[model samples]
Target: MARVVVEVMLKPEILDPQGQAIGRKLPQMGFEGVAAVRQGKRFEIELAGPADEAAVERVRELAGTLLANPVIEDFEVHVAE
Candidate 1:
């Protein structure tokens, strides 16, 4: 099976409240030296056959349009080795 991996993350300029919360809580939980945190989504799409150029391109298009929001998030789609 072929695997297409999609990684989605918030834009750098956007504030990440959840990440900040984690960052804050870690220090209180005795986890020091933690500076910052950012959270993201990873999607693994399995196909019946090997990933080709066209298939990767299609997945990239799908990720941009349906998976990640253009206004607040960015995404990358690639074939998993």
Candidate 2:
């Protein structure tokens, strides 16, 4: 079986309001010294076949088509045996 990991994040130029809000509240909540914080999405997928080129292609397609918005977000894919 193969394992695929995907990560999706907003573009750097885009503002991450959720992350900024959390970061601001952390210090107020006494979680002091939190320099910076950012949020993103992580996904883990299991493939029926071995970790091969086809599996890699499938993961790439999934990420590009459904997992991420190409206009505002970027994604990375990783495959493991």
Candidate 3:
């Protein structure tokens, strides 16, 4: 079996309320030196076969269409080590 990772993040132009809330609270919680915070989603997929180029392409397509909003978000897919 192989593992594939899909990471989805909002576009730089988009507003991230959840990430902003976390950034604001971090300082209050004693976390310092934080420049910024952006929230995103990660999906780990288990494949029945090897993590080859074909698998990566398939997962990338899935990420673009189903796992992320192409209008507001971008995604990357990779094979896990």
**Cα lDDT of all candidates, in order?**
0.92, 0.88, 0.95
- TM-scores for the candidates: 0.93, 0.88, 0.96
- Name model 2 segments beyond 4 Å from true: none
Q: Across residues 1-81, which tens digit of lDDT does each residue of candidate 1 receive?
A: 899999999999999999999999997899999889999999999988889998888888888899999899999888888
Q: How many backbone clashes does candidate 1 have?
A: 0
**Backbone Cα, N, C clashes tallied per candidate:** 0, 0, 0
Clashing pairs in model 1, backbone N/Cα/C closer than 3 A: none
Candidate 2: lDDT of 68?
Answer: 95
Q: Candidate 2 deviates by what RMSD? A: 1.4
The ten-residue window of minimal lDDT in model 2 covers: 49-58
lDDT of 1: 0.92
In model 2, the clashing pairs are none
- Give the winner by TM-score: 3
